[model samples]
Target: MLIEAAGLCAGYGDARVLHGVDLSVGEGEIVALLGRNGMGKTTTVKALMGLLPAMAGRIHMGGTDVTALPAHRRARLGLGLVPEGRRVFPTLTVEENLRATAVPGGRWSLPDVYALFPRLAERRSNFGNQLSGGEQQMLAIGRALLTDPRVLILDEATEGLAPVIRREIWATLARLKDEGQAILLADSRLQAILALADRAVILTKGEIAWTGATAALQADAELQRRHLAV
Candidate 1:
């Protein structure tokens, strides 16, 4: 597995949002983490990225234990995250935002990112706050790509975008998958996930409710209703 977490437990203050979650993303694979709101999907992503400390669990990257590492260390070890809200630096130019956390001598570069999202290239000089929501999302994904992550984790991959932009993002993800990028995606869009992910892991109140191939998840309507219905 490129990224693996076993018995991951975390929370805010004393609130314990996640409980014994186990998930993994292998090389050249796409895994979708699905659940309704407040079900610890984001917490799981944060824990794996080292943004949130694991209360009791183990996280491994390329078979090396990384549970004790900090966020920067995890990034160095090849964990890249596109957070829920597309949190780009408001004060930085688009080019600067891409460079802020970038690791030199990686597979990604400024020109490559710009080519992937030409809109960003067009707005290269604009501050993060100056861009629209979809532009910010593209910038976020581009910034993460610049890290050359072994496992790219995206939380709420496309939450609040126009239909066209959402489709564009999904298409970009498909292209990434084609190029053998290992991705762990947490999103509410079921149909898109089913089409893109190889495997599916469903969560309910922090614990894993069900896990299997995406085909199985798509076929089980009752299971979806039980754990994923809004």
Candidate 2:
């Protein structure tokens, strides 16, 4: 498995958010972490990335125990995160942003990222703040890829974007999957995720409520209504 997170427990100072949540992503597999608002999806991502301390858990990446590693160490160990918001550097231009965190001799190069996202190449000279929401998203993904991570974790992969742009991002994700990228994605769009993910894990109130193949979840509407309906 590219990522193995088990017995994960984390929370803000006084409010506990995750309750021993467990998730895994294998090589070349796309896993969806689905849930309604306040269901601990983002918290899970934070814990995995070491952005927030894991109150209790074990996180293994490429068979290495990373529970104690800092965020940067985790990144060096092949974990890349395109966080909830497309948090690109507002002062840096598109090209600079892509260069800032790039690893030496990485599998992904500037040309490769630009090829995946032509819009980025067109706006390479534009500052991060100058880009539209969709453009920022593209830049974020491109920047992460430049790290040549073993597993990519996308929190709210396509949120607050035009439908056309959302589709474009989904298509990009599909292509990445086709290329043997392991991904853990969190999003509200049911059909889109179901179409892309091999397996789905549903969270309710910070605990895993259901987990199975995507096809099984798609066939059971009641499960969706019970845990995912707004």
Candidate 3:
């Protein structure tokens, strides 16, 4: 497994959101986390990223125990997060934003980022705040890719975008997966995600309500009605 977490318990203040959540992402596979809003989806990602302290459990990357590592350390260990929002540096130019957080692993460089998202290359000189939502999102993905992470985690990657932009982002993800990228993506588009994800885990009330192959989950009407339908 490229990433694994078992018995993960995380929360804010005194309120716990995740209850012993367990999941894994295999190398070169896209694992999707599916659920309604407030179902600990983002909380789970935060916990895995070590942003939300894990009250209990283990987070392992490439079979090494990193449960105690800080966020920056984890990043060095090849874990990258795109986060829920496209949290780009508003004050920085596109090139500056990518330069500031570029990793030295020598795996992904500025040329690679520009090649992956040519649209970003066109706006390379534009300040982050001046780009459209889709452009900002492209920059966000580019930023994460520059880290050359072993496991890429994205939360709400396609949220608040036009249909064309969402499709573009999904296509980008597909291309990355084709290039053997290991991704753990959380999104609200079940049909779109299911099409690309090899496996799916559904969270209900902070627990794994259902887990199965992506195709099986999509075929399960009962499962959809119980946990996915809004």
Better of 1 and 3 by lDDT: 1
- Which lDDT tens digits does candidate 3 get at residues 1-230? 88899999999999998999999999899999989888989999999988989999899988789899988988888888898888999999999999988978658999999999999899999999999999999999899888888989999988998999999999999999999999998875587897789999999888999888998988888888777743
Off by over 4 Å in 3: none
lDDT of each: 0.92, 0.92, 0.89
Candidate 1: where are CA atoms >4 Å away?
none
Judged by lDDT against the true structure, how good is candidate 1?
A: 0.92
C-alpha-based local distance difference test score of model 3 = 0.89
Q: In candidate 1, which residue pairs get closer than 3 Å at backbone N, Cα or C atoms, i.e. clash?
A: none
TM-score: which is higher, 2 or 3?
Answer: 2
Q: How accurate is candidate 2 locally (lDDT)?
A: 0.92
Model 1 C-alpha lDDT per residue in residues 1-230, reported as the tens digit of each score: 99889999998888899999999999899999999888889989999999999999899988799999999999998998999999999999999999997788999989999999999999999999999999999999999999999888999988988889999999999999999999999976587898899999998899999999999989988887887743
